[model samples]
Target chain A: MKIAVDAMGGDFAPLEIVLGSIEAIRENPHMEVVLVGDEQQIFTILKENNEQKNPRITVHHASEVIGMDEHPAQALRKKKDASVVVATALVKDKQCDAVIAPGSTGAAVAAALFGLGRIKGIDRPTIATPIPTVNGVTVMLDSGANANSKPKHLVQGALMGSEYAKLLLGKANPTVGLLSIGEEASKGNEVVLATYPFLKKLKTISFYGNVEGRDIPKGTVDVVVCDGFVGNVVLKFAEGLVTAVTQLVKDGIMAGGIFAKLGALLVKPAIKKIGKRLDHTENGGAPLLGVNGVFIICHGSSKAKEIKTAINIAGDLVDRKIIEHIQKTIEVEGAFKYEYDE
Target chain B: MKIAVDAMGGDFAPLEIVLGSIEAIRENPHMEVVLVGDEQQIFTILKENNEQKNPRITVHHASEVIGMDEHPAQALRKKKDASVVVATALVKDKQCDAVIAPGSTGAAVAAALFGLGRIKGIDRPTIATPIPTVNGVTVMLDSGANANSKPKHLVQGALMGSEYAKLLLGKANPTVGLLSIGEEASKGNEVVLATYPFLKKLKTISFYGNVEGRDIPKGTVDVVVCDGFVGNVVLKFAEGLVTAVTQLVKDGIMAGGIFAKLGALLVKPAIKKIGKRLDHTENGGAPLLGVNGVFIICHGSSKAKEIKTAINIAGDLVDRKIIEHIQKTIEVEGAFKYEYDE
Candidate 1:
């Protein structure tokens, strides 16, 4: 399998992206990587990592790079030769099976929508993010793809999320839950209330009534479906809370004097293990589902390890034929029959 | 001042509620409490706590009790003599200065709207929840009061929340941030986008542009204003994430063998301190702002400590004349001049 990596996308840019791609190719003998960015920068990093002449490693030249803060659609339109768009184009042209971009989420979504286009029946593409829960991970869809969504869009997200959960999380029958403030069918805002009945009537996915915000961390359901607005807020809030909690622990130790310092040293390994489990990098990137091709979006601050994992995840998706599964499920279930305003 | 307590409200109702009220009055020499619930149950708990004949303690009989699982508006309409409604009625009738309900948030909101009514010129009442942050507290308005809100309603919420910060958080000039997925003014859903221009044009609040979900935990602004749907989901998600993190730390310690166990024992005190700092109970209860009377709503699982703090908070709100301040701010700012749909 071959995958295209946008080397000039994230904060670490070409160097870290190149190193991670090299590492990913070394671990998977049958896999190959095409690093899309400035040729000179890619080659210099490859030489420094001692993989410059490796047969499995290749470089594709792209003149422009999109900054982290650039407006996605505008940047994609102006920078026609941008690394992220070029990488996505490789997948569109069937040069690679998948593409990975570790830049602004908006840019990634725009590149996918513009380059590969959406599947036939899907109205909008979604970003399925894996959140670490108590027992395991729960996949939340439309994490930040579309700012505003209709009930039909959420129904499409649920179908796509259910398929992703089955392939990625290894769930036999994924139970989908609508994210809401209350657990009752009669609860939530107008959008949620309208979406609930559609999910209940659907036959392709297991609709698990309604789940509250707390239920996400409790691992109450396999897939959580919501519009991008609420899903994005919840995702970012979880990240912030984890950081604040860790800082609180560090401050507590400082205030405890000498005894707490010694205790922290003794339990350093245990704390490190916990951090690893909760680390976002360990899960790689969230897949931009419903797109025509495989597209994974990593965090902007992603380093070499995260990029490598994301490449491996892209390979797994290709092997499982995730896009094919989503297309078939949507068609068979007739998800497009629901009335939606353009 | 006298405050009415919903003695039949929470999980540990009557017993814990009565004890909390007794403790609150003991701390505030000038304060009195009226326990509104079934007379027999309240008296039995009061006698057990040795406060049956106390001069400052009083009991008002309300034959019906609203269960936690009951629907809010329906239950309020059917069970006219419910404990929560009676407590709120005490404040409406001017028999008590304020009311504290440590039960279903829906019941508290419903009773407040029905009994005390909304403030003049205010379209809806907002729940201003005080979230503990790294620096101090960040007050988020419309946390769960109205699931759906318009731009004008949010503008009213901002004015009410700013006044709340000035009085409760002790901010001389509080800055308010409109919560959105991005920091840019053009980045949120339809409602948030429409609300931005109104907030910027208004002279009452110090508009701090847009803030993301992470800003809430980081204490980036004094007041974070959003419609209740997003605010409620973010609030509950924070609670869930904190619990999940704590459990992760515990599981880590247990997995690291005997040394980790010993380390945990040595650092128990420091850990307890951190836990106390992050505890929601420490902040007491969130006030239902924009109402005609002072109404504080506590968590459903609140214990005696939380109830006590909430009662104390209710007294503080009455002393500060929070309702009058909110009313004045709305009238002075001409917040009702904006066009809105009912």
Candidate 2:
């Protein structure tokens, strides 16, 4: 399988991106990576890593780079040869099976939306992020992919999320839930309230009723759905909460006396184990589901290992035919459009 | 000051509620309690606690009780003598300074809205929940009070939240932030984006730009403003995340050998200290702001200590004249309405 990588997208840029591509290729012999960025920069990093001679990796020069802060839709339209745009074009042109970028989420989303476009029956592409639960991971969708979403869009997200849980996480008949403030059917915002009845009527999914925010960690449902606004807040709040707890514990341990210091020494291994589970690098990137092609958006601060894991994820999605499954889910639901004034 | 207690509200109602009211009255000589619920049940619990003759504590007969799952507004309208409604009515009738209820948030909000009504110039009442940050509490408003809110309502929420931080939390000039996915002005859902310009021009508030979900725990802003849907999700997600992290740590330590168990003993005190800092009960209840009278809502599963803290909070809000500040905020802002099709 071939994948396109936007090498000039993240904070670490070309160096980490180059190293990660080489590692991904080495780990999977059948996998090939096309690095999209400035030719000189890519070649320099590749030469330094002694990966210039690797047959599994190749460079595809792009003339421009989209700034992380630029307006995504406008940037995509203006910078036609920008690295991410070029990489997405490769996916459009069938040169690569998927596109992966560790850039601004908006830019990646814009590229996928404009370049690869939405699937035939899909209303909006969703950012399906894997939230680490006590048991495993729960697939939460529309994680800030679209700022405004209709009830139909959320229903589409639920379906896409269910497919993702099944194909990616290997959960059989993943239970889907609408993320709301309460467990009752009467609870939640207008969008959530409207979507509940639709979700309950769906024949394809194992529809659980509304799940509260606390249920995310409890793994109350394998697939959680909400608008991008709420989903993004939930995702980021979890990230921030984890960081806060870790810091507080560390401060607590340090503030304690000599006994605390000795205790820390003894519990170092256990702490490391928990840390590994909490680390963002251990999990791969979030998939931009419901798009026509496979696209993964990684954290901007992701290192080489995260990129490697992301590539592995991209390959796995292709191997499992996730996009096809998503298409099928939408088709089976009859692709019924429930339009709202955008 | 007289405060009405909803004796039939919470999961441990009548028992824990009666005990807490007695504790509150004993703690504050100037404060008086009017228990609203079944007179027989209240007396039974009061007798069991040996507080039947407390001069500061009085009982009011309210025969009906609103179930936890009952429709909030409909319940309030139908169950006129329900404990929560009766308690709110005491405040409405000027017989009490505040109302404290450990019940359904929706029921409490509905009761306050129907009983006391919105303060002048406020479109909808809001729930201002205090999130415990590393520095202190961040007063977040519209924490699921209204599912649908106009942009103007959010601006009013920010102003009210700012005043809440000033009087309640003792922040001199609490910086207000519009909770969004990014700090950029262009970021967030349409409501948030529209609310941005209005917030920036509000002279009554120290309006900072957009803040993300991560900023809440970081205490990046003293007042975090968002629509009810997002705010509720953020609040619950944070609660869930804290629980998840705590459980993970406990499991990790228990899985370790004897040395790890000894380490846990050494860190127990320090952990307790930090846990107290993160504890919701220590922070008190969330005040249903923008209402004509003071109404504080506690979690349904609240214990006696939480109820005690909530009563203390109610007394503090009444003492601080939070309702007057909310009125002043709206009056100063010119009571402008940004109309949406509701």
Candidate 3:
């Protein structure tokens, strides 16, 4: 099996990306990786790190890099050889089983949707990320794929999210919860309220009723589904909050003088572990679900470890035939009713 | 000024309610309190605590109690003399300057909307709460008043929230930010997209365009305005997360052996201060903005101190004429354009 890695994306680009690909292929001896970026940059990193001798890694040269703030569609259209676009194109051309990029999420989504195309009967693809919880992690879908979603899109997201959970989290029957303002079915905006009845009628996924935002960290449901707007806001907020809280604690300890400093030193290791637990980097990458092929989008500041995990996840998804399972779920459950929108 | 207190509401009930009222009136000798609940229960708590002799405190008989889970409109209708409803009635009838309740938020909103009614020319009333940040607090509103809102409603929320920040956080000119998916004005769903232009046009408040969810804790804006659905979800999520993170840290510290244990003891005071800083009780109560009368809603699990703070907040609102200010802002800006929806 082979994977395409975007070697010129994220804050720490070619160096981190190239190192991660080397590490991933070294661990998985059966897998080969095509590093999609500038051939010179990739080769330089490999040589400098004494990893150029690795047989499992090859370079697929791409000239341009997309800015993190670049408009998705415009970036892809203009930079035909962008690392992310080229990486996704490898999967689209059937040269690679999966694509991994630590680039602009919008760019990744745009590239995936346009390059690999959507699966049969899927209206809008979703970006699903697992939020760390006390018990385990909850799969939050449409973490930022479509800003405006129809009811059917959310139902599709639930089914897709459920399958993602089953394969990734190893949950046989993942419970799906609609993200809403209140726990009651009647409580939410028009889209959620309209989607509520449809979700109840779907027999494919185990549908739990509406779950509030508090339910995310509580791990009340295995899969929590919503439109991209709400899901994105919640995801970003959680990420920022974990960092802010950790900083606040450190500042508080620092301001408390010598006794507090001594105590902080004692509990430093425990606090480090706690911080690791709260970090999203521990979860590797978020999957762009509902697309035809495997595309895992990592954080823009992703380091080598996170990229390696993303590669491993991509391999697992391909081996487990997650796309086939999702395709079958949507078909069997008859979730794609185009007439419903009309 | 006289404030009506809902004694039978909240998890702690009449005990905390009575004690808080006593503490409130004792501190503010110029203020009077009406304890609205079953007279026997109120007397039992007051006399048991030997506070029945105070001339500033009086009991108003309320025959019924509304359960926390009871339907809002249904509870107000069925339990006509419910303590929350009666307390609100005191304000509606001009017998009390303000009302404070650590009860079901929905019930309080319903009573205020029905009893006190919307202030003249205000299209919808909003529930505004102060979320603690590293730099003071950011006032967020329509925290959970109307689940569905028109574009004009959000504009009103911003104006009211700005006034709220001024009165509560003491920001003379609060910069209002529309909570959305991105910093760009073009980002967000249909509601926010439509409301953005209105907020930009409104000269009454200093508009800061759009703010993402992370900005809530970052304190990027003085006031963050959104529809009730999003606002309520964010508020609850923040509350739940603070608890979960603190618990995770404590559990981690405990599992780290004797060194960590000793450290925990030493930094315990500093940690306690951080906890208090994050505590919503420190902010006192969330105001039901846009209503004709002042109504401060405390947390359902509020203790004596929290209730006391709510009472104090109510006094401040009444004394500062917050309602009059809100009414003046709305009227001057001409935000109540009922025909605009058409």
Our tally of clashes for model 3 stands at 0
lDDT per residue, candidate 1, A156-213, as tens digits? 9999999999988898899999988899998898888999998998889999988888
Query: What DockQ does every candidate get?
Result: 0.77, 0.72, 0.73
Q: Which stretches of candidate 2 lie over 4 Å from their true place?
A: A337-342, B337-342
**Which tens-of-lDDT digit does each residue in B230-341 have in candidate 1?**
8888888878877887788898999999988888888889989878878999988899998889999999888888989998888888889888888888888888888654
RMSD over all Cα atoms, model 3: 1.6
TM-scores, each model vs. reference: 0.99, 0.97, 0.97
The candidate with the higher TM-score, 1 or 3, is 1
Each candidate's clash count? 0, 0, 0
Worst 10 residues of 2 chain B by lDDT: B333-342
Best by TM-score: 1
RMSD of each: 1.1, 1.7, 1.6
How many angstroms is residue B138 displaced in model 2 relative to the true structure, after the best TM-score fit? 0.3
Candidate 1, lDDT over the whole model: 0.90
Interface DockQ of candidate 3: 0.73
